[model samples]
Target: MFVTRSVSDLVADSEGEGEKLRRSIGPVALTALGVGAIIGTGIFVVIGEGAKLAGPSLFIAFIIAAVTCAFSALSYAELASSVPVSGSAYTFSYATLGELVAFIIGWDLILEYGVSVAAVAVGWGGNVNEFLKATFGFVLPDAISKSPSEGGVFNIPAVFIVLLISVLLTLGTRESARLNAIMVVIKILILLFFIVVAFTSFHSGNFEPFAPEGFGGIASAAGVIFFAYIGFDAVTTASEESKNPSRDLPIAIIGSLVISTVLYVLVAVAAVGVAPVDTLSGSDAPLAAALNEGAGIPWAGGLLAAGALIAITSVVLVIMYGQTRIFFAMCRDGLLPRRLAKVHPRYGTPARLTLGFGVLIAILAALVPLDEIVKLVNIGTLFAFVLVNVGVIVLRRTRPDMPRPFRVPGVPVIPIIGILLCGYLIAQLPWETWLRFVVWLVIGLIIYFGYSIRHSRVRLGEKADAPSVEKA
Candidate 1:
């Protein structure tokens, strides 16, 4: 049960019929994918939430979150290079820790990626509503546009966007990557536009009390904005699709984190400088609202809103893509139904799993108010990061001779710091969030013990007859 699949065998298995993912993405596209996923909800929506908690010290919060992410990103870079598989942390844990631990991490990732896509979709719904109102003077009623928690019957726009992205993904990975890259560029340009325009109206008084609530506030803000940095690991999920996983995976993972960090810091600084903390906190479309009301640029608000729509769409696309890949890996390993592992004959994508995720995310986006649940995504992601750091340490001690294309600079120190920081962030989450995570894990354990343990191909030796499975 604890047997780990050799990297060489896994690579060989990937070449099997109907299971192979196309290797079309390069380092540039992978980096763009990371940036696309990382920049969405955090910069566009969560920044206001962070600013509310930390005041003008949101910039410091961004730094704190970035530093914490840097530790985990290095670990991810190392593992992605060494493992070069589809399952991100899940695959790493299976190879290092054990199948049970891998299942747990994979389940946690479902919470991270699945719930995040839903949450981002909700955010997207808000921006779509704003954009519609700004552009065409059309408004969606609260009953149809908001989740029940937010006094709406359903969030139709959110559901619509998820389904749209799912269809795009089902068509092909390369096509989706190109569209994602384009959207990323457009959003970045819009953000730069906001920064330039808002900088002209910067007010020193807005930062009077940089840490109004003190260090505690900064810590709280860091926890809030930590969600922004959640997507860099999503790049690792594309390991199978990367043209040169060993070299390109590390570059994509690290490069995306660096690029997004700088943009987040600059955007946070510009946002607070142009608007009062109170105003930003109260806004639904914070950046656009800041530009319209605070900076006195009403026209720019429309442009920013349009950019946010594109930004959130890219985020939903990449995140859902990550979720499907994780599920595909699990299915391939017999942790899930094998049908989920089926790749489309024509598109070479996991069309079935993509549709499945689309349906579930659409229901969540349509009916659930995901504000409180966003914190759950953060806690879940941090838990996965902790396990990943631990897995890196375990792999080093157990497989010292393994060839790693990109080794983390500081082995024990970096991973240790990563585990500690992730643990701290997890602690900062509300008790309610912790309760939900525990409940979710309990459910996963039940499913695992009941079915996965019995069905896992690794345990059953089902692959013993296959030549490729024995090659390594």
Candidate 2:
């Protein structure tokens, strides 16, 4: 259970990097992938929920979350560069911690990425319906456009987007990266348009009493809106696919976060400036609501709906992309069936695993109530981030001689702050979310003991290629 993979083995595995998967991603494309994933459902969908909790000070929550992620991103960049592995935090833990801890984080990440994709898909359905109603003035019946709890049969658009992204992923990695770049550009433009339009009606008076509920409110909202920052780490999962995981992964991870943090702050300010908290938080589509009713700019609201479609489409693509790669890594490690790790001959991608998980996620998006689970997802990702930060400190002590392309400036201090901040956020979540997390972990432990232990390549003393950022 305490077995560890030697760092030498990982460096050896990354040596001839493009054997199984193609390495076509440069820093620009890789950063775009991170941006594509980071700027999705959180900003477009859940920001309203945070607005309700923090009022105009929702922007403050964005800052808090960004600062926390900024610290963790440093640690993530360090481990990501040194390992250049596919599993993100899971891979790092396997090298620094031990197999049992690595498996737990892997299970935790599987939940975080899989559920987030499904939740984002569900939110995509709402945006699709909003766009249709605003443009065609015709709405799909609730029966086919929402979950049963929301007075609908099933969410068709959610499943449709998931299937579409899955197909795109099956085509190839470079193809997906190209499309993600295009979407990232369009979405950024859309956001800038929103900011310009929002400023047209900006009211400084709307920000009176900004900290309505005080730091307590901002902290609570930060716990919720931290969901917005979830995908930055998703960049590290693509290290295997990057042309230079050591150089590019750090750049992509930190660059994507910097770009996204600026947007999040500007958008939050514009949103509250254009409308009162009561009005913006009243509806699910805060940005649109701020435009259509508060700012009386219906046309801009309509266009914003269209931008959301493209934005969320890329998010699903990148997140599903990350999840499949993590699954591929786990399987290749023999913690799951190794055959499932095989890439498609022509596409150089994990075609079957991508499509299989996409379909399952689609089914979940259609049937499950995902709104409440956002916090559950937040706690899981936070746990993974904590492990990654801890992995950095452990690796320093365990392998002080390792070469690092980029190092966190403050060593143990920065990583400790990350762990503490994450712990604080985790504590802010409800007890019920903790209960669900414990149950999930219980099930994962069963699988680990019953199957993973026996099949694990490390425990079996089997020789296999180490997973790296370079695809091949």
Candidate 3:
């Protein structure tokens, strides 16, 4: 019966938990956190890879990804406002979808947060290495800076940054949030510089064969570039801290998506304008390289490199924040150890989980090559987005009268489009990516049946009279 409580009861339960903490974040800061998490190394590095796969149609790919994200954000906004909890989709899924789905979302979230942190950390080190060599006449030895896939040694700087951010996260969320805002400002300013400089060297001839690679190529690029819009959902993690969650949570989520999409389009346009598409496709740092071509400024590349370092750092911080909070929620539900959910006595943050994730991510960043794990992150994120969209409609039918802070304006249509778009993009990933996703799910099943099912707080209590676990 407790497991099948009404939607209002779940909301009340979340409030009881969340109100113990202070609500200090304003809408602006929340929006900045969203932006800080979204606009980073994906634009700097992966956009080029997307272009290589999609051609000029990569622009359309951005729109496709953003629209899909917008649908999920709408669903997220409603759930965040209604529950005002720390766990984001993990909490929402628990209340409405059941323990099994919640566990899968939690498992997929590991990719979203943990894997992403390592990938972004590696990117940060690469950019920092470039800037140091150009400005200080010092180059990090290949033994320390390069990923093994790149034919060098371990990425020491990346591992170092992850360790430092983990310590900061343990110190406090409020402090980490402030630093994230500042990093967001720095990243945006550098992107604007690229936009301004690249436009000056615009050549109409560069866009001649816009869709050189065909529609299938464009679809694949959308799969790859889908990662660029990853952070919009991070806003849901801050739901517990918003002053007026119902009014502000949705605004922060949707607003961040709209803002990021525009910025990405501008950056892409500027990048394509300043250089040939083929040239840009091959670049590891497209925006910086484009600015160097257009403005003839030797230092433009250095500035962009500096921005990439900060941008990647901000992303690592925000995602790590999300990871710990999700772990905290799972722990409280008895799906994980309760000790992992304990908030710091002084800081009021999940220090144990934060530290655990930090150490795990640092180890991952140190040993795993970046190219090996990026696709797994992409597929996991898309799967989560699919659920958010489906869950929106399910919740609507099951509990329509529940208070919705921000309803999707075109509920059925929007969610439907959201579902098809997510499926289409998922279809474009390689066979191995699907295999990896299946393996991840099977492993999650093992843990769930082996541990979570037996230990779950709901299961440990008297069995609810209402239905089976699937229906519950």
lDDT of each: 0.87, 0.85, 0.77
Tens digit per residue, CA lDDT, model 1, 1-472: 4667666666666665546788889889999999998988678788889988999999999999899999999999999998888989899888887888889889988877888889888888898878888888898999989999999998989999999999999999999999999999999999999889889999879998889999999988888788788899999999999999999999999999999999999988998899998888998779988888778988876788899899899999999999999999999888988767777767878888899889998998898767777645467678889988998898899889999998987889999999999887776677888788789899999999999999998787765223212111
Cα lDDT of model 3 by residue, 208-250, tens digit: 6888878878777777777889888888887776778888888
TM-score, every prediction: 0.94, 0.94, 0.91
Ranking by TM-score: 2, 1, 3
Q: Count the backbone clashes (under 3 Å) in each candidate.
A: 0, 7, 0
- How far residue 246's Cα lies from its native spot in candidate 1, in Å, is 0.7
Who wins the lDDT comparison?
A: 1
Q: Please give, for residues 1-472, the per-residue lDDT of candidate 2 as tens digits.
A: 9898887775444444322566778999988998999998678767898988898899989999899899899999999899987778888888998989988888877887888889888878888888988998988999999998889998999999999999999899899999999999999999998899889989999998988899989988887887788788989888787898889999999999999999999999999998898877887778888888767888776788888988888899998998888887788777877777777767888787888998899999999988688546467788988998999999899889998998998889999999999898787778878887888899989989999999997777766554423234
Which residues of candidate 1, in runs, are more than 4 Å off?
369-371, 375-377, 464-472
Name model 3 segments beyond 4 Å from true.
1-6, 17-21, 53-58, 147-154, 214-217, 375-377, 460-472
lDDT order of candidates, top first = 1, 2, 3
RMSD of each: 3.0, 2.7, 4.9
RMSD of 2: 2.7
Rate residue 114 of model 3 by lDDT: 85
